[model samples]
Target: MNVEKIYQGTADKVLRGIPASSGIVLGRAVVLRNEIFVDTHKTIQNEEIESEIKRFDIAKKNLVAEFEESISHIPPNAKDLKAILQADLMMVEDKFMYDSIIKFIKELHTAEAALVIVFDQSKQLLKHSTDELFRERVTELDNILKRFIIHLSKGEKLSEISENTIIIAQSLTPSELLKLIEKKVTAIVTEVGGITSHLAILTRSYSIPAIISLKNATHEISANDEIILDGYTGHLFINPDLTLYKFYREKQKRIAEHIKELGELIGLPCKTKDEKPIQLWCNANNIDDVKNAKIVSSPGLGLVRTESLILSLNRIPTEKEQYDYYKTIADTAYPMTVTLRAFDIGSDKYADNLLIHEDNPALGLRGIRYLLAKKDEFKIQLRAILKASKHKNIRLMLPMITSLEEVIQTKKLLEECKLELLNEDETFDHDMLVGIMIETPAAALIADDLSKICDFFSLGTNDLTQYCLAADRTNESLSEFFNSFHPGVLRLMEFTVNAAHKNNIPVAVCGEMASHPLATSFLIGMGVDELSVAPSLFLEVKEKILDSSFKQCQKNVSKILKTAMLKDIYQSMDV
Candidate 1:
């Protein structure tokens, strides 16, 4: 089974996967693929060297101008798009890149060959990056370089777009996405991508409906085929009939109204109708995420994945480098606590330096286990976190801990790093709190014991659901089994919250469940102290919380836990 087409409607010609962006639009399909392959080893004559250099310089200048022009045309709301385009501009103007390519050109290589060689070196380096965002940036770089190659070769660039175009592609780089936005494309459907992909992020920022990871979307749909893309539900209908089109058209209106309603709730406290205060926090993936969290009035930042910094640079960042990144986030979210989870790599993300092959990677070396095994790497990250603790609002959190012993060992290791920092007469805030993620079933069951040692417990519902249900969340066929609302998973959540509160430790849920409307009320009812979600959904989830009643939710939860059948639970909860 293809994981990309994990979700689909009963209709025969519908494709689905992850919902990258929300909204609905009906437009003609416009398949796009902008791939440029070149032979870098091609040699050139001595006389052509000077012309080659001139051509390279001219193309480089044109590419930079093109990127700047693209950025200038992007709507003001698309902040990330502007930043990405600016980065592309910088890449084109990079001094080292020019020097390296010029040197290659002087060695009797064509300009195109030189450009490809120099860019390939950078690509090879970034190919090992474990961070998805950085990898997406590399894809954007690839697109820009390809455009440069096309310009130098005097070839045409990407195909033109038509009005009301619904782009169908195997994948799109950020630059391609920006180009689509510039063309006023209505929607995007891709064969491969995820929610965090730059293309997906850009689509969402541009308010363009997009469904990605729909396996073979380009092959399945033809050009000018009437397409209805429902990005909110992750479904794309090829040549949809009038009935389906009308249904989605109505849905689009309702969604727009609902979003407007949610926007009104922004700046309001995340409290139940009965006046129960619930702390709302945003999960930060980068500096922009932190900024969005601030905009959404998120009380604090929860679950900042620290591995991204290393992945983006494709190297184990030095202590100072890591410290700087953490300090920036901490300062950006000043007066608000920033909980930084130490490198949660392995399993889904494989760093270049640390390569481990496991048949059952999910259950194997990942998260805390990976961190513990790589003590040197762990120590460096800890030192960086401790150094950044000087901001006072910084908190350290450990991921994938299935045992209390792991928590104790991590604390001891943190102390060792602290002692080393002290020996060097470095200043750090030792008073910072250390939190642990209750992700595994073992961790949830022993939440009581772990709470005794940790300051807080962050329920990682995504992994916890997978582990509790004994189903791989990434497996398309087992999607039904990987339910966060499963009785067992819900019971574990309830138990963890109870245990954490019993020990006077606050429990926060920083997972997809917290952001989901269906699960938000139940989480609040379960006595979850904090709800952390994607910054975009923070206001909507808060709106749900504000509209809910704690007492009613508690009552509903009691009935839900008692219900034995999943269908009955769903019917009762109206989810």
Candidate 2:
């Protein structure tokens, strides 16, 4: 792993990490730091106020221009990063923020100090945000502010990188990543980040090969050392031998071919070989989700995770804020429906404000239980969803409902929220369909009763499977037991689907089960009307469905239901 040894083309090889993006690359290593130091706490004299404000304005313009320039260089399919960059751009152009900073400057705060004060308030709030994802955004925004301050004070710039360079670092903020991207950096390796991190999202958007959470990556990787990055597999081969090089080169070609095939299926309907029309939708966390879903011809958005918006901004959004955010998704999806799920808050999503603590958070006060107790917060969200439904096709969905009583109470609250909106003369959709996620065993078992009140049912199989099996999906030690395709889990899905259909309601599978190609056939066979998944897996699942006959899939599912063992189910699928 040393520089000399790597150069000699023989060293410890094959580092595994989280696959952040998919692609293959062979290049020399380039190291990067996560942030640039800046003095952001200085005060200013009255005489310096105008000049300082001018300086701040100039830096803001420059940063925005840089971000806009970066957007042009990235691939068109990289809509996620493009939307993110546009959001940052919106923040830079925020009139209220600008006025506040100018006011601070007039009050004798230095330009940098004013900038720090304004953004620090947002950062502090984000620190306590519900989801860990938004907390990560706080750090990202901090790095961005620091970079802007550095640009204003010292005119600092990114380190120069040569072509075909793979960036290795302890961490990378989106701003810094873009800097390297401008120099045509080939790939990236980071020691810390997750699938939802800005770095991971950006890499995927840009189609860059990236592996994250490779512990001690900076310590092991040397500058200018030859490295092979297989981001699809989360493998990094250092100082690879000729044989290893040839193996990866061939692997790259196969992956490229597979992607090309998948790409060709875009815009095609997801109909089975027997001509049964199956609806394809996508789960979305933000506006980018709607954009991606539309690109893949997803007829609608199955899940618009509202909690992410709350966490990302670090607070419960105001009616206006929520309206604007939801409207953006509605606008993006246009005539297509957007199923906005109510916040399924829990201790696990970093919603400390929602719950104090629970010994077993998985089975604790969460989902509908938490929302019911916090009626005011629940009302705010419901009202917002109703208002957004005025503009585009929208369906309001309640998450984590485990009983008929919860459904009844939620409907009552929905009526109350609608009445309040009517009193205020606020425009909203009065007839928007309200659905519930059948994620709990209790919910699935009693789905017949719940479906009577619900307009639709969307299966959250990820949680349903874990709850049914009484296993934590995240617990590596219990990994063997966290089977979503278990006979018991499949039976619950079957039961829920039948219950919805019995009531003449449409049911969609919007969980990880639907995204998997192996499970796609079985789910189709089981009479699932719709499948909602990540946009990246759309074509893959579509291909599976197109090659299957619904009648055959029904037979396969029937065989699975009668089977007693997990091994037998796999044997039936030839997995």
Candidate 3:
């Protein structure tokens, strides 16, 4: 039946959230009720610690086996899932949790209560730990307690469900969700989760529709109600009218078609309608991302965030290790360019080992400032990049350089690093291209001078817009002012791009703004040399370039930048 013929339903309140992943799919609602069990304590003699340990051992073995089985079913290409499984394996024999359980058993003498205390302590531990490994370990421990509670309460095994169900729950531990590997589970909806929560990451990896932070989701959603989930819009509908269903169904079809077309376009050069070549680059964080880029036929790596590598290491990676990692990408790309941004740490992404904190991290010591404070660490990274450049096409971009003085100071440090390498008789490329991120208004204003020293400029519009408008993007209260389409922001960007061009320096955009299709044309029209976006968006943006003309984009940009009102600008530009 056509959507036009479907009966209309009463409008419901619409809630909004950030779309972490993009897609459209409609499936049956499989409401998952989170099973919570109370722990009972039993007193055991100290002599029984060994016996208790044995019981714990057996439980862990069974749990590990279950998790392994689940991991085996995950596609080999699912790096995110594999990483989660690795975390589970790392935490399987957690010494602290096991010892705590054993101690509780010996002191209180009750296995059941000891198990309860262990589970509770584990949850507390997970709360304190930001490492995905530790969190996954806690999830594993929680699963054990859940099953034990179920068996103690004489509850039935979790019912095997069909694939088209939307799994609803108060919270889902990674282990529990992974175990339900039957393909029928089409979507996940949880009442609890932050933006960076494990469930959110899993949902993104699986390409499933999810809604989190719904305080009343578990209680609000009924079992098996025909539902529609627009993950792109973060909207959940119960018994949606036929019109809505038909609309989304067609949307789903179009999305599938678009993805297929993009896949086909892989390996082809990205060119505009006028045959002007635009560099289509991918943002990569690690070796896995580099590998994934090749799979999607991305021509180059735009931004290799070094912070991810540093955070993953137990200690600071040696210069050699860093060089190897950088070299791998450089060699792989060969002739293709890779712009590795210097560690851009601040706010939510600082190295734990460094222990650097600030009153307001966003505005405080971060990016090049933090690196400058720790000169030795910074030099090691610089030397590594310089050495790697000997082998492949690699360019350096400094992050958060607010003034030309910072750029001058950074170049001095680079010179010192180069001298040290030379003294060590290290044969490396000293002619590597160097650039700076134009993220702040001050940087944009001084772009003319900065362009003289730097080889290129990359406009980080995400932070540029935030700083220019004096509004934090993360703050929902000031979202109105955080508009990227604001005339002020576009003017600043235009000025920076013009400044870079006048100096014969190419300018690229590697911000979230660049990923928007509407903004993509505007950026091209503003004389952006390249567009660095998420790998998923690479081909789509390339397609838009092929379909659009520079003249039309220039006209759009002119209209957009004329209006002071963001909403009016967006409306006029059809954005």
Best by TM-score: 3
lDDT of every predicted structure (CA atoms): 0.79, 0.79, 0.72
TM-score of each: 0.74, 0.67, 0.76
Model 2, 380-412: lDDT tens per residue?
888888888887499988888888888889999
What is candidate 1's TM-score against the reference? Answer: 0.74
Model 1: how far residue 366 lies from native, Å = 2.5
lDDT of 2: 0.79
| lDDT tens digits by residue: candidate 3, 311-372 | 55635688898988888878876666788998775433334544554445567776887778
Sort the predicted structures by lDDT, highest score first: 1, 2, 3
The predictions' CA RMSDs to the true structure, in order, are 6.5, 8.1, 5.7
Model 3 lDDT on a 0 to 1 scale? 0.72
Q: Is candidate 1 or candidate 3 better by TM-score?
A: 3
Of candidate 1, the 10-residue stretch with the lowest lDDT total is 1-10
lDDT of 1 by residue, 274-368 (tens): 99999999998788889889887788998899876755564578888998999899989998899999888654354355466554555667788
Task: Give candidate 2 regions above 4 Å deviation.
Answer: 1-18, 28-162, 167-176, 189-194, 212-228, 233-267, 346-365, 420-428, 465-495, 549-575
Evaluation by lDDT, superior candidate among 2 and 3? 2
